[model samples]
Target: MRPSGLRHHHRLETRAVTRFEPNLRIPGPTSLPPSVREAGGRQMINHRGPEFAAMLGRIQTGMRPYFGTQSEIAVLSCAGTGGLEAAVVNVLSPGDRVLGVSIGAFGDRFAKIAEVYGAAVDRVSAEWGHAARPDEVRERLRGGDYRAVLLTHNETSTGVMNPIPDLAAAIHQESPETLILVDSVSALGAVPFEMDGWGTDVVVTGSQKAWMAAPGLAMVAASERAWAAMEIAQMPRFYLDLRRHRESARSGETPWTPAIAVIYQVDEGLRLMAAEGAENVFARHEACAAATRAGLEGLGFELFADAANRSTTVTAAWIPDGVDWKAFNGEVKRRGVVLAGGQGKLAGKVFRVGHLGSVTVDEILGAIATLETVSVTAGRPVEVGAAVAAAQRAAIEAGIARVPVAAGA
Candidate 1:
């Protein structure tokens, strides 16, 4: 018998199960490597010291490849959302007409941020779990007098990755002067995003997401066009002022007191990623997402996002019918794997499995196995073992690792 969150009557197991240090499977503040943890534990140093400058230098240089910009990158003591706000306030003024290109919840949040700051936002929406297409963006741009455009590289809520390059092209073709601001919070370092190549003016990300580091730091990179907008755009910003940050970055420092501990951890994480190679990291994330999705489908689960727009960082899916998703999620947690529950309208309708950052093949399979045990105990048993095998096979096919035997064996 297993512990059930459902009070309506479910099997109960007297054999107690204890799992320590549950596997974290959330989109941000992802699983950190031992080295990053140790780095964070180091004694505090002078934020204005030479040592700090060197550390900051290393972080900036190492992270540039992933940010896909030769331009300056600024690290702020803020999360990804803060970075998005900074991008908006710095580039556009109050009542400035902006186009919000939304695919899911996060994209909606991006637009709301602009609206809150007094930007007149006109949104172009796509169905939940589906990405915004280029044709739709071009259509929106055709008639609007937008001063800036807001886009999200990855929609964590619905597990969708938009076609940013194509969208950028359409925006450029229709409204070349409008600043393009992108939220790459959960996508950078884990997916293919070339900011400079795509001609994006501003792109922002956080240290916690695919950086495999702790939270408390947001990174922003800007092209010359965005910096030009910052010079004239006035939105009464003080703490998030990028002009001050830009000047400070030249001196290898931040405009304000930074998150020194998270910075230390980010330095280590960036070091590891640099050694791993950017292309390799992206490949691993893609392979892991593929394997996780295949495993979920094998277990008789339906994916929430469309296959054509599925994200490589997280996989969102509906729990099988006849099983309370909350109860099923609790079982997974009790078994030592904490998956992220959905939010907003998605709520219990979906569960998200984050496979980005440092997630490995073994971790995915272990979580699947735990879900299998819980599902069977819940009386909705499926041959999840075969699904586990499918994941292993997919990994092998992706050149991630070799499998001893297939699931049927």
Candidate 2:
């Protein structure tokens, strides 16, 4: 998908001063860096040409370190969900008993994919707003001989970041032979992830989240064990086949005609990300998330997720008791700040503010100011500027600047 326009220009608001641009503060399809946007609009090249190969090589090599893996990562022409499906189809055969460890919506989707493909899936679900605990998975694995264990590193729906490293360790301790598949679509780049260190067999992610690019591309990293599992897998697969992508990557190509523009976009985005350094990028996300949570709490809004397990990429908060949340989001949208309403059972109950990808401290503060305006206009109770002040204080305590350096400064 293409990016929504990101502008620094201002339009006077009669009701309240306009805070930011048309803020696309949704969970996915986050705002892209201007350079990535520029690169994506460039003329498409021959997918099979040497020029594409060299570009693909740069992207692949640059991406390996983000997931903390040296193994092969296959870039495909699909959304992040496709990467999850590829991981499923590549590892388990039909009728293979597997454990689906679910935290929220994405975890459930991963399980559904495995079941639809004929894997006998058993689910271990965590409470909504909480992460799947390692002890629970360990307890379940103790009793079952599953072929694989599915996990979501960060559950976007609930704004909970699972303890993957601890969970992976638990899985390894209990079932050494079982494959560990992770759907880290919204978490991998924006959050801390370790595929090799955590013993994750397969990890799936997308371009749209924290990669600072447009949608329509999925990146999948498979361990040697996952590749070994592909050899004996009998589940039906063609387009979502990891083997095809893996085999083609050796020649710096995809099995199908890929989204060449997105590849170019990710290459440029990764270049910018690498220049910033991964730790700094991750730290930036954490600081923004902290600021957001502090700001939201200061607005007298309760966060949806458990405080200890909140995600760094998105902060989901409950809509005030007397306000129409859907209308509130629309009001925020009207203020030129687009916030994400919740998914599944959470629809109209919670709102998400995306701080992933290319958002800045000043931009987040703008969104905060917009929320205050929307709250006041919608007649919901809020202390004017209290949230922004809390956020600014939190940022300072975190060693993050309250204001951001403007682009091209």
Candidate 3:
């Protein structure tokens, strides 16, 4: 006769066990590549030691080409919000007037940050899921004694990519002395950001999103003009000080203890991206986004963003008639896919499908398949096989699917 514990073990072994599958979807803090994930498991080192300093040096050097700048790039041990704060506090004095463009949640946060610093913030607000027009921004700036204009390059909340270059041109023409600070958290690596070329003074981004690394680290690149303004700015700061970061980074160091694990991961991610080439990396994101949009359109879902300004990182789709968003999303979750939901007023009315960073065509197609099946099961009819075909067509037309491997590989 078997022991009672042995019988229980046998019974447990006979039952179907759930296995964890890695996430292949979601906008950011995207599935890290194996190399990047492995980098984090390395032995932790002293933040002030030469090993960590060397690591920071390499990261700063790697970030230059990606940011399209020769200006100083600072790594802060905080999230994207910290980068935003650094941008604001490092460059502006109390009672300075600012014009903030708000098209989504993140943009709203910029305005709030400005207000917190005692800056008189004037908002050029637009409906969520829409891009703020350059003319509107120009018109607002004309009315105020604005010291700087803050813009969100990609409003992740609404899947809208604002026309930053155009807005930059408009701001320069109207208020050349007014600094231009951009929150590029969702767009930086996935899209082109030419800081000097575009006349942008300060640009901030996070390690997640298009960088394809774990969250916690924030990167900010500031132009010479922005740094010049920092000289007279009276806003108080210590750890988030850009000047301190710049001074230390010159010798490959940080003011405070840095997140060594995240720094290692960022280094690996940047290495992978550099190997692929920056333009190629951006093109990959564009292809994924275009395919995603095409797939969604083919399925007959209405887009929340204007077609021209849709973000190349995430796509927001309106829940169709007769399909319950709750049930549809539930099915997606049940099938091991997670999607972002609408924010603020659009909550429950729209759902976001992220196609940024390391996502591939097959993975996106799988998501489309899941979405189509769930919509159909919930009584919404999507044209059979249409989404996948459209996505394929878009990918092929963009020449992204035909990317040539490097000679060695």
Candidate 4:
């Protein structure tokens, strides 16, 4: 007889038997790579010691290519939201006129941060599933003497990727002096962002998303113009102050104690990324996005984001009709594939699949297969293995290596 511990209780019959093989498919606090997870477990080091200093130096310098900037970056021991707050308070003063472009939930949060910091914010919004048009942003900037413009590179909530290069150009053409601050927490490593070439003044990202690490650190980079503005702009900052972080970074230290473990994970993640090469990293994300979208569509689910503006890191699809979101999600969870729910106004109507940071086509295929099984189990009509086949083909066409087959007798 099998051991009692291996047997399932009747009371928990419906629970997913995913004790050892759970797959994380959420937007962030993503599944870490094996090497990165190992790095996180190395014995803790002195935060003020030379070893910490060297690690700090490597992280800041290593992250430049991802941001596409030569500007100095400050690594703060906070979440991505904290990075947004730092961007707001460090660059604009109370009552300063600002323009905020919002396309989804994260966009709204970036704008809201500006408002809470006392900036007189004027919002330019797009439909939830669409990208903000450059012409619309230009029209808003016309004849307005704004101190700064807040932008989101990728709105994780609605699965939209804003055209930052085009939008930045429009802002500069209309108001050259206006500083451009971007929240790229979900875009930097997974997608390409050219900070210096695009004339962006400030950009921020977190460790959890594309960096393939656990969450805890936010990396921020600012241009010379932003630094000039920081010297005078005051919105009352201490712990979230970019100036203090930057100063401490010059000495390979943080003003406050850093999240040493997460930093270790990020450093190792960066090394892996560097080895893989940046362009390849972007291509892998593109392939994963293609696979996820194809799989969801093959299963008769409609995608939520507009066609041309879809995000490469996360894909949002409308929950199928007649299926209860909670029940469906629970079944999927039980099968070992954990997905993200719709956020804000989209709550209960959509499901998001995150495919960034060390996620592979094979893993995505497994998730697609799981979704197929769950859908069929819920009385939904799904063509058996159709979604998985579609995903495999899509991944191959998008430049990922084709899956290998076993030798037959």
Candidate whose lDDT is highest:
4
Model 4 over residues 94-199: C-alpha lDDT tens digits?
Answer: 9999999999999889999999989999999999999999999999999898999999999999999999999999999999999999999988998888899999
Q: Model 4, 258: alpha-carbon shift in Å?
A: 0.5
Tens digits of per-residue lDDT for model 3 on 255-314? 888888888988888877778887788777778888888888988889999888999998
Cα lDDT over the full model 1: 0.85
- How do the residues 168-265 of candidate 1 rate in per-residue lDDT, one tens digit apiece? 99999998988899999999888777889999999999988888788899999999999999989978799999999989978888989999999998
Those runs of model 2 whose alpha carbons end farther than 4 Å from true positions after fitting are 1-21, 401-409
lDDT of 2: 0.85
Model 2, residue 44: C-alpha shift (Å): 1.3
Which clashing pairs does model 4 show?
16-334
Q: How many backbone clashes does candidate 2 have?
A: 0
- In terms of lDDT, the poorest run of 10 residues in model 2 is 400-409
Go through the candidates in order and give each one's C-alpha lDDT: 0.85, 0.85, 0.84, 0.89
Query: TM-score of the candidate numbered 4?
Result: 0.94
RMSD of 4: 4.4
Q: In what order do the candidates fall by lDDT, top score first?
A: 4, 2, 1, 3
